[model samples]
Target: MNKSTYITAENPMSATFRYLAISIMFMFVGFLFGKLFVPASLVYAANIFVVILIVGLLIFSLMSRKNVIPTSFSMNFVYLFTFVDGILMYPILTYYLYDLGTSLFINIVLSTCVIFAVFAFISHKKPAGYFIGLGNILLTSLMVLLAMTIVNIFFNAPVFNILVSAFGIILFSAYILYDVSTLKHYIESGRITCKNDLSIHVLNLYLDFVNILLDLLRIVSDLKD
Candidate 1:
């Protein structure tokens, strides 16, 4: 396979890389559009609708006969989902920009990339299924985190807030490892040979990366304040 080409089943690793790259690219596109092209209100206004669209598309993609991926719809919807997520992040990022300026944003970006790389490296070096067994625990952790977030809206305790952010970092870091380990399983087992499978994996890692960055940003800002 050429260094630069669409990933086919023949080269699953390359395909995975390509899909991840596309995921990151779409995220950047959405963030840039949100930052430069329009106000956050527009995206905020479309938030509910976009969420519906994202969910609908996800269901449709999964159910469609074309779900094997390499199908246009699968690829397109993957991009669309990430793009929308980036747009949704606009307000939060914008606020950070205003409060902490560009330096924090840049540092967070670098931190995310480095953290992902380190975790990915570790995942690759480890045996397959290393983190796969943690799937249930990971899900439970997220649910617990979500519940805490909602509760914090009312309590607003400083100690609790810091703990939440710290937990966010740990959870997402584990997630990156989990996702990568799962990707290895998928490729080796020939379970997710198509683009759809790759896209789903990419989405998982992309989300993990995004959350980790957000958590890191929050931690840094908290320290500064």
Candidate 2:
């Protein structure tokens, strides 16, 4: 309910990961609820709603970053944001689950977990400075990726899309390292003294994992086609 409830000096990493795990569980629940209860006809509306939620979360995050919002409030917002994200993923889940089959879908989920764990472990073992220094380079690459994505929207070339997906995977993988390392540094340096500080890192890792999974799915689907 508050900073002291979740985080402590003795085991900050444990507490952060515990919260992250819970957020992932909420996401799965949202995904199942969407798949079973929500109609596919609402997919377009869901997408629009998700975009609005994203924008709202961005604003909320900025306010929280400035220490204007309470840690407890921000923590609740993280769960809500992740749940909405899971609901938004319903269409993608349906495509992989129904169209690609259960086995392949399971494989994709397992692969995503494996990839996420590997990078997280790598970041843990390295010096925080190693990943912190990569911040600007990664940001610049992301901008370029965004530009290419926008161009591909107009051209819509199959090969170009494949290239973009590949780039996205690499970029987001690096992001996982950067995010994890940065958070580790924050925890060590006493920068993350409250629950509110963890919210952004949780969201960052969530986005990184999901983006990698989606991009991997795109690449595999393209290869199969």
Which candidate has the top score in TM-score? 2
Estimate, for each residue in 55-137, the C-alpha lDDT of model 2 and write its tens digit. Answer: 34334433433446553347677788778878877766666566567899789889999999999999989886569888878
**Lowest-sum lDDT 10-residue window in model 2:** 46-55
What TM-score do all the candidates reach, one by one? Answer: 0.78, 0.82
RMSD after CA superposition, every candidate: 6.0, 4.3
- In the range 61-120, model 1's lDDT, one tens digit per residue, is 233212354432366677887788777666666666666779867888888899998998
lDDT scores in order:
0.68, 0.72
- Any runs in candidate 2 off by more than 4 Å, and if so which? 1-10, 42-73
TM-score, model 1 to reference? 0.78
What C-alpha lDDT, on a 0 to 100 scale, does residue 37 get in candidate 2? 81
* Candidate 2 TM-score, true structure as reference: 0.82
* Whole-model lDDT, model 2: 0.72
Judged by whole-model lDDT over C-alpha atoms, candidate 1 comes out at 0.68
Local lDDT at 70 for model 2: 53
